[model samples]
Target: MDTIPAILRAAAERYGDQPAYVEGARAVSFAELHDQVRELARRYVGHGLAAGEPVVVWGPNSIEWVIAALATTYAGGTLVPANSRYTGHEVADLVDRTGATVVMVADGFLGRSQVQELRAASDLPSVRAMGELSRLSLDHRGEERHVREVTIDEVEARADAVSPDDVADILFTSGTTGRPKGAMSAHRQSIGVARAWAELGGVSADDRYLVVNPFFHSFGYKIGILVGLLTGATLYPVATFDVDQTMQLIESERITLLPGAPTIYQSLLTAPGRAERDLSSLRLAVTGAAVVPVVLIERMRDELAIDHVVTAFGMTEAVVVTMCRDGDSAETVATTCGRAIPGMETRIDAPAGEAGELLVRGDYVMLGYLDDPAATAEAIDADGWLHTGDVGVLDDEGNLRITDRLKDMYISGGFNVYPAEVEQALMRMDGIQDVAVVGVPDERMGEVGKAYVVGTASADEVIAFARQRLANFKVPRLVETVEALPRNLSGKVLKNELRK
Candidate 1:
């Protein structure tokens, strides 16, 4: 059961009547989920979706999103997820690059029509069909007017045709140095990584997972959705992270497994009326994405009463590289992302305890970047190790501690913010001569972007200009004007000086 569909089938046989997914008023058992996914896969095949084709799913975290994404793979099509916060212009670039034939959007999310936004952004000549994700009902008996009708046998045939080595997803991750590149992962790699994470966390069928991370990310998709499929754990998806709502869900759902960025725990620790909330049900807590203070990890165990609090480090290319164990000390969990999981190897380029570029090679590393051979070659060397642009060191105990980043990228509320991308977007504004963006410390969001501009445009005007072009998280939160940006002999902006 190396493939997702195979794992799903196994889950159905093992956990049949158990609740697999619970959304608001709807709940689907493992057996029912399998049937629904197959039915939707039939719809995809009926619409002439060829094997190995790409389908883009642009929506928030929901049962419909889960079904649609799995159905794409079940129909032998590649799943390309679009960030819900991405503007239409951004999504259009991805759809065009992937040559996606179909796009399913969550229209009217956050008060914007996703379909209309993509339409206005580009004609999307490669896209042959577009469907609203909200209309995709899991009920097999309900009417679905979007896709063509096909037989269950046809869907089963398509699923059988899909091999474990075939491409399952092409997740687009922004490069700190350049444009976003689609990291391709096969079915085996995706399922393998999820299985590793589930095993490390000791995830079980009875554990209720509260997923606050967006489904588009590997954290929520591979670890959140696929982990449930492999372990039979029931998943409760949270589209947005409202502290009050999340606390309420934890108590009401009796969630046992909760994994998210450090900010989520910070919010919960300081959230209003938190003492009254019964959070004793929480057992396993995994957090990462930004620096985790030792105090935060200690507080989570003390105040929240969670038994296991661990941390992990991962990227788009390799989903689960290193993770802390169940009984790891609070200081160890806070300072280091634990040893590499089984079937993976890690090494620092410098001497033993010294910080250097961290390199990883494993069974779960991405095959390569989609249609970008040059970039792919540069990333993964001939030796087969992927050069992760992060600076870290390995302690004597084999724990990997990330000290610095080679790339000027930061995490804001668990979202990767590449400074180069923000700088490029800021340059588009008129009267802007030069700009340098740096990640500044923020208590709420792990880090926020602050732009240093050497231009005539006012800070307010520059920020306003970026708001329309980039996503809210990508936009710079603060702006400062300088006479000129400091540059080195090689003409690279000295971001360190700007940070000072």
Candidate 2:
């Protein structure tokens, strides 16, 4: 009950014969997954790695991804999952920052990108490919079998001797700053988050989940994977986010639950044969990351036909605070981030209709930013409330409305301009897929607005469109058309990288 391993134990007892995980054509049962983790723990302990040391789970979403994670935790080590979409140097910078003791990457990860980083990494740790580990399926095939030279008896013997509360994972923050910050999470934190999500989402064993998002993100780990496990539900993992592929998988898998950015939902609306497909099985669709526009939410309501589209707002610091509740209004669902979840407190420094920096405090807030006391002090106040850098306003009912990001706001000619406002206006233009607005230095204006747009329209056309919607001062002075926007693994826009 205190850890995820306990839930694994429960599944082995009540649902051992049930299908626990299915990857493409391969399926592993409850007992099968538990046994696999047990052996994985032995393999890690067999190596010289000790508790609290870091082991990187670097790969596309796979059964092995979960296995490596569980095994690392079961062996009492910290797991660090690398973002598969990131460049090698990007990945190396993260690993180097965490100072991992060992890294588990898929074969040919280096060949995929210039992230030949881990190999050239100075003061590097041990590395392993998937097949190199002698751990087997821990299958109960009615007869004893050997996994390489090792037996199931050997694996179980090693697992039975371990303890919980050993550092389970060192989840490094998506490094917006040059150096990534590692958040040391325990087995208890995983369980706590999953439990909190179950209450927030009302998830159950009957729910069938479809997750296209990567597990490294807080939403995927806490809600997609962790909540699914807690509810005894079946989870369908899509390694990558392909709008067309997800549409088909939803029907094929009979998906009932989903949690991802509004981008996924936006893209799904355009999937071919979208209206032709039978998608009646879906019940819950949770979106986070960027704010959900009312138009997108309306299209989802009238088009995709999913009624209960819940939106929750949170960060790695505060687990999850605001979530639009059941029977909440479309305007509320689309605009106002709903009332605070149980055990969470929310406040706005400005008047009800005015914007202010959002503050959240709860049992789920992270202990502190790992090793950076100054940043920890700056982020979390003496009262223990985490000051989320997000800028938003509180409505009469205490629901929060996020207008723009504090960091993304800029000053132009002594006038304040929020890039989110400009980006939102540009996104409404025809053929526009995405748009990002930033501020660059201007001798006269201090900072001038610049827009990077991704769409079929030319720079002049976009500028023309923006000129009509915004004031002359607010209109972007520079427009660069790009194929796409740079985003982090969680689908959050990497504005820091975009600025560079």
What TM-score would every model get versus the actual structure? 0.97, 0.75
In angstroms, the error of model 1 at 225 is 0.6
Give a tens-digit lDDT track for model 1, residues 149-179.
Answer: 7889888888888899999999999896648
The reply for model 2, stretches above 4 Å from the true place, is: 109-117, 123-166, 174-177, 351-353, 409-500
Tell me the lDDT of model 2 at 145. 26
Q: Give the range of the ten consecutive residues with the poorest summed lDDT in model 1.
A: 137-146
Worst 10 contiguous positions by lDDT, candidate 2:
133-142
Q: Estimate the Cα RMSD of every predicted model relative to the unseen true structure.
A: 2.8, 10.8
The superposed Cα distance between candidate 1 and the true structure at residue 74, in angstroms, equals 0.5
Q: With candidate 2 superimposed using the best TM-score fit, by how many Å does residue 268's alpha carbon deviate from the native?
A: 1.4
Model 2, 1-500: lDDT tens digits are 65556666676677676766777788877788788887776666555445666777666666777777777665656777766555454466666666665566654542453224445544344332223212322221112322244455655544444444544556655322324566665666666776876776778877778877677666666666667667777777777667777878788888888777676776677777888887888878887666567887788777877868877777766667888888888889888878888778897656767888888887677766667888778877999778777789887787888876666766554334667767776888997889888888764455788888887888888889876555455678888888888998998788777778
